[model samples]
Every structure is written in C-alpha cells, then in structure tokens.
Target: MKSIVILIFFLSSIIGLGQDYIFLESKNGFREIKLGTSVENYPEFNRKDNSNAELFKLSLNSKADYVYVGSNDDKIKTAKILFIYLTTNNNVISEIKVVTEKVLNVYAILNSAYGEPSSKHGDKWIWKTNNIECSIEGDQNTIPGYHIVYKDISNERIELKKMKLESTKKAQAEL
Candidate 1:
C-alpha cells in the first residue's frame, strides 16, 4: 500500500503538479474572461445558435438572468476545442463549460492552467478557491472527451437563492 501511494505521488509530480497559473485568472473564469464582469466586454462570443446536438442545447437563454454564450473560434491552449459555453448571470459571466477534442492533452493543459486539482473523485478532478470552483471530468454520455466546468461560487449562491425563493413562491401559490 505504501509503495502504491508513493508511486502515485511520483507520477503526479512527473506529470506536472503545481499552482503555477493560479494567480492568472480572475475568480476562475475562462482565460482572460472574468466571473463578475459583464459579457459586453467580450463581443467576440455570441449567443449560441439553435443546434441539434445535446451538447449544443445546454443554453438557457429563455431565462431572464442566465444565458449561455459560445464561440467557434475559442481554444483552451493550442487548438481543437470542441465546445466552449459561458453561462452568464444577468449578463455577467458566472460559469464556463468546455468540451475538448478527444485526442487533446487535457490533463497536462489543464494542469498548466489551473495547477494540480484540489481533489479528484473518480474521473472528475476539482479545483476550488474561496470564490471559484473548477472541475474537469471525463464524460462518455454526451461526448467521448473531457467536460470542464468553471464557475463563480458567489454567483452560484445568488442563483440558488433566487431558485429557492421561486420554489417558495410556487409552493405558497397552491396553498
């Protein structure tokens, strides 16, 4: 057991483990994008169009507060980023969803960007801060590649509160 544990650590170190790029992002938003900023700053990304794929139908543009924006030309590090979805809260970016190509070196690239994951569960690796939560996991259900979610914790809380209030209102409406 001891040998197995040591071996795992050794391999992780060799695979590149460190919080090298932790200071580069503003609360875990994508690349130069930020969590609390208005989406108007990024005119490069437009509202995701109507598409037939399950991965493409994730946007909730109908909601007054939440919106998903994407661009076909976005890339994580080098190239071949399959999908990039940015979910916004009242026009402020709150979450990011990325699905990379199957052959991409996802682990290494993600490690370089967010440093080593704070924790790992099954195939999912999560990195958390006081205000941001980021995770990347392998999903075969929608795509045969990686699915990454980077979100703002505070905005998430706000959304959750709104949902709870709505739930309460609905329950009282039937009373």
Candidate 2:
C-alpha cells in the first residue's frame, strides 16, 4: 500500500513539473503563438474576416478553424481562446475557459499537472493558486468545461462578457 502511494506521488510530481505547457497555462497561446506575441508573426494567414483590434480571431494551420484572441490590456497581453479561453490586461492573461467533450482525458491531465482541485460546485470543479483560479464544469450527459481564472484579476469588460455568456448558458439549460 505504501509503495502504491509512493508511486502515485512520484508520477504526479513528474507531471506537475510540466504545468507551464499544460492546457490551462497554454491558454495564453498555443504552439508558436503565445500571449504578447506580435500579430505580425502570423503573416501567412490573413486577419479573420470579422476581427478588430481588441477582440479578434486567427486562422491557424490545424484541425480547429480559428482561435479567438481577446485583449483588455490594449492588445498587450492578448488572450488566446482555444478549447480553453483566456482574458488579459496590461499584457498578462487574467482568466481562461475551456469546454470540450474529452472530459476524462482533460481531468486526468489537469489532476496530474495541478494536483487536486480547490473546490467543487455541482458539475464544476475549481482549483486556485496564488496566481490563478481554474475551474472545470459539465457532467456525463453534457459537454465538459474548464477554466483558468487569474486572481486580483484584470479586465473588467472581459469578466462581464464571461458572466453574460454563463448567464446565457444557464438560461438555456433551465429551459
């Protein structure tokens, strides 16, 4: 029993060390693209059709059609919204939201990387550190969701938008 516990602890620690590139942390950006990256770097693809300076989308060379980017920091710390969405201000990511069908895979990976979650509310699970707050929502019958929210946060407008989105979802669910 002690050996099994030790093994689990050892494996978990190894996974924890790689959190910098995990789904939540990478919400800042993906692959070569990262928060604070210059828009000019992606010269190969044109700016999305319905994008502006603050909130925009970028077409990437991947299975996903486009990645959403939102900046409340004057395009400084721009947040890249993939399966995990982020909001930023003054060039730092402040929050993240991830929704996907791969609940078990995501949960196992996050648990290994960040340890146990900090709280739980219904189908949602939350993990908070000094620097960030992350949450996962959904259940077996619905889509799985995840989020990484920053603390002493920045970008009120983005927060409002997030709230509106959640409200819409809740209203829909009720009906």
Local distance difference test, per candidate? 0.65, 0.46
Backbone clashes under 3 angstroms, per model: 0, 3
Report the error of model 1 at residue 159, Å: 10
lDDT string for model 1 (73-99, tens) is: 655555456656667767887777766
- Candidate 2 global CA lDDT score: 0.46
lDDT of 2 by residue, 48-148 (tens): 23553222332111222223433333121222233434343443433333334433565565566667776788876666543345655555454423333
Count clashing pairs, candidate 2.
3
User: Which ranges of candidate 2 are over 4 A from the true structure?
Assistant: 1-84, 90-92, 140-175
Error of 1 at 118 (Å): 1.4
